[model samples]
Target chain A: NAGVTQTPKFRILKIGQSMTLQCTQDMNHNYMYWYRQDPGMGLKLIYYSVGAGITDKGEVPNGYNVSRSTTEDFPLRLELAAPSQTSVYFCASSSQGGQSPLHFGNGTRLTVT
Target chain B: GQQVMQIPQYQHVQEGEDFTTYCNSSTTLSNIQWYKQRPGGHPVFLIQLVKSGEVKKQKRLTFQFGEAKKNSSLHITATQTTDVGTYFCAGDVTGNQFYFGTGTSLTVIP
Candidate 1:
């Protein structure tokens, strides 16, 4: 079973460009999250969804947006890429309410120039 | 917003030596989890502590939660090269968001 799948393992974007980071989980988890990890830093929450049609802002959700239209998908969108936004992005899912262990995707290495 | 912080931002130890990382939360936590991330890899869940003053062990690794439920620690009995990675602590405050600590990078010298 594919726990969590993230598309565009690596991507490079010019400043002001926009892109979407796709995330899907086959585990039928109810909770999904988007996080970014900078060099030598911990994961910073960006956006999260508890269930379909429900989403919320996380600790670091300024430059990004998220939508959960279906139970299996939660995608993160970067409206305008900036150098500071260049980092490794990860998608994660949990079966229970943030109380369960999180299953994370391989991650997407994004670079903005 | 609840904050979780880790100490010893970076550590280097010789093989066979013990290592530990501490996690402290700005407020009381409902629970806390530990994760390990290898170089250029995603974070993987290690263990979770829910009860105050709880302790759990995974072979060579030991995890503990403070009595106040606001702090935790992970201790590795004997470090190995395979243990080289960054350890992070995530705390659940409101049961909705789990704030992650800054993380402690550990390097083992063989």
Candidate 2:
């Protein structure tokens, strides 16, 4: 059913460049999140949205921004990319805030030179 | 800030052997969820535990939640090659974010 979809499976950016990571879900979930995973490390939360027109900062929101303009879309934006920002980014959605299982997208691998 | 930690970063077990991974949270959690990520794949939900001192089993796998709601564990009996993956424990605190543990990478050898 295409639970969650992330665009641009892979991308490369030079320092100071900007790009957007697109995420969309078809399950009509209320909670969406953005996370980054470094090699051999756990997923770190970047930004999250409880519902349309509502967003909040997560554990690791630096150098990233997010917007939830509709129920089906939550996009992450990277401005002035840095080497430290190079990592695999994942998008997830859940039916509720807690106690619900999350549906995740395949993820986008980004490299910043 | 809440944090979840997992032990035994890597584990290798022969087929038919048992495997276990532990997770601890620095703060009390409202609920704990387990996920498995296969090689080159996104995390997939496995189970969720909410009650204190709760124990649940799914076929060959067993899951337990600490009495204080700050720790959890997952044990697998008679492991197989299909069990190879990185297991992660994610805790939900204050009803908002899901903080994930470092994860335990398990390998089942034939």
Candidate 3:
């Protein structure tokens, strides 16, 4: 059903480059989240949106920003990518916050050089 | 800071052997969810435990939520090659966000 779709499965960015990570869900969920996973580590939240026009910072929100303009789209932007931003970015959505199980995207592996 | 820690950062077990991974949270959680990510894939939701001291089984996997709701465990009864993946426990400490554990990478030797 393509529950959650993410673009650019892999990318390489030069230092200070900016890019956007696109995420969309067809489930019409209200909760959406962005998380990054370093090599051999767990996922860490970057940003989240509870509903349209609402966004919030997560544990690791530096160097990144997010916007939720529509019910189906939550995009994460990297204003000035750094070497430390190299990680696997995952987009997830759930029917509800916390109570519902999350549906994650295939993930985008970003490498900042 | 609500942190979730998992024991045994990595595990290698022979096929047909049992394996278990533990997840402990710094703060009490209202619910804990388990997810598994295969090599080169994203995390996939496995199950969730809400009630205190709750236990649920799915095929060969068993998930248990401690009575205190601050700890959880995932046990695989008879592991196989297909079970090779990283297991992560995500806790909902405030019913608004999920803090994922450090994760336990499991490898099954066939």
Candidate 4:
């Protein structure tokens, strides 16, 4: 079974461009999160959803938006990309918040020039 | 805001040597989880420590949680090439948010 799946493994965008990074999980998890990792740095949370129709901003939520329309899908939207947004974006899911281990996707490498 | 810091940002060890990475949090954590990410790969769950002064082992890897629940450690014995990766410790603090440590990048030489 595919635990967590992310589309467009790699992409390059010009400044001010907009795009959506799609993430889906088949494990029936209720909590999902979006994180970005820069070189030699830890993963920084961008957005998270407790369940369907519920979402919250994270530490680095600026310039990004997220929507949780279904239990299995949590998509991260970059409205106007900037050079600072060039990083590896990871999607993760857990059965519960703060108590379960997170299952992560391979991640999408985004480069904004 | 809660923060987790890891020491020795990068470590290089011989294949048969032992390596340890320490993680400290500014605030108490409900639980701490460890993950390992290989080069050009995603982060994978290694282990989770919940109780105070807890220690768990996975083969050659040993994980420990401090008594105050604000610190943790990951020790790898007799490291091999397969042990090369970036190790991260994520702390679950109040408000259900995770604060990830800067991570320790390990390079095991053959």
Candidate 5:
């Protein structure tokens, strides 16, 4: 089974472009997270959802928004992309709480110029 | 804020040599998780430690969580070229968010 799937493997955006990064999971997990990793740096959490219809901001959620419409889909939206937003974004899902291991997607590489 | 800090941001070791990366946190953690990311690849789950003084092994790799539950380490015995990757430690202080450590990038020279 495809544990986690993220769409638009790669994208290039202008200074003020808006886009959405799609993420879905087939594992029926209740916990999903969106994280971004800059060059040579540790990942920073952007947003996380504990279950459907419940979303919260993480450490770096300034330019991003997320919505958990269904248990299988959690999409991250970039309202106004900036150059600083260029990084590799990963979507992960865990079957339970933090005690469980996360299943990560292949990641979406976004380059904002 | 940076809650967790990892030592030796980058490591270059010859094949067959031993390699170690450390993760230290000022606050107590309920559990710790380890992940490895190859160059140009996403991070992949490796192992997890739950007990205060837990230790787990995988073939040539060993993972240990400190007795205080604030520190953890990943050691690779007889490193190989296939082990070249960036290792990360994520600590769970609460059940909500997962914060990552500084991260250690390992480069094996074969």
Candidate 6:
């Protein structure tokens, strides 16, 4: 089974543009997280969902929004993207919250010019 | 928010040399996990530690958790070329989320 799937493996957007990064997991995990990794840096949490219809802001939530409308899907939206938003976005899912191993998607490489 | 930091942001070691990376957290952690990311790849789970002062080993790699549960370490004995990657430690401050360390980039010199 595809553990986690992310759409738009690569994208280029101009400043002030908006786009959505789609994430879906087949494992029926209760926890899903959105993270971004800058060059030569660690992953920063953007947003997270404990389950369907529940969402929370993370450490670096500015300029981003997330919705968990379905158990299998959690999408991150970039509003008025800036150059600083150019980074690799990863969507991860875990069977449990902060206790189980995380299954991460390949990641979306976004470049904002 | 809890913060996790890793030392020696970058390390270069000769093949077969030992290497270690340390992780420290600003607050006590409920659990800590280690992950490795190869160049141009996503991070992959390595292991997790829940008990204070617990140690686990996987072949040449050994992981340790601090007694206070605020720090952790990963040591590789006779590191191989395959060990070249970025190592990250994620500390769970609460039951809901984890704060990831800055990461240590290891380069193996042949």
Candidate 1, residues A5-105: lDDT per residue as tens digits? 99999999999999999999999999999999999888899999999999999989999999999999999999989999999999999988668999999
DockQ of all candidate complexes: 0.85, 0.86, 0.88, 0.76, 0.85, 0.84
What TM-score do all the candidates reach, one by one? 0.99, 0.99, 0.99, 0.99, 0.98, 0.99
- Full-model lDDT for every candidate: 0.94, 0.96, 0.96, 0.95, 0.94, 0.95
The alpha-carbon RMSD over the true interface for every model, in angstroms, is 0.8, 0.8, 0.6, 1.2, 0.9, 0.7
User: Cα RMSD to native, each candidate?
Assistant: 0.7, 0.6, 0.6, 0.8, 0.9, 0.6
Query: In candidate 2, which residue ranges exceed 4 Å CA deviation?
Result: none
**Which stretches of candidate 5 lie above 4 Å from their native place?**
none
lDDT of 1: 0.94
Interface RMSD of 2: 0.8
Best by DockQ: 3
Q: Write the per-residue lDDT of candidate 5 for residues A41-112, one digit (tens) a residue.
A: 999999999999999988899999999999999999999899999999999999875989988999999999
Kindly list the per-residue Cα lDDT of model 1 for residues B13-93, writing each as its tens digit: 999999999999999999999999999889999999999999999999999999999999999999999999999999998
Candidate 6 per-residue lDDT, tens place, A1-113, comes to 98999999999999999999999999999999999999999999999999999999999999999999999999999999999999999999998889988889999999999
lDDT of 2 by residue, A1-113 (tens): 99999999999999999999999999999999999999989999999999999999999999999999999999999999999999999999999877699899999999999
Encode model 2's per-residue lDDT on B1-110: one tens digit a residue: 78899998999999999999999999999999999999899999999999999999999999999999999999999999999999999999968679999999999999
For model 6, residues B14-109, the per-residue Cα lDDT tens digits are 999999999999999999999999998888999999999999999999999999999999999998899999999998877888789999999999
- Docking quality level of the chain pair in candidate 6: high
Report the CA-based lDDT of candidate 6 relative to the real structure.
Answer: 0.95
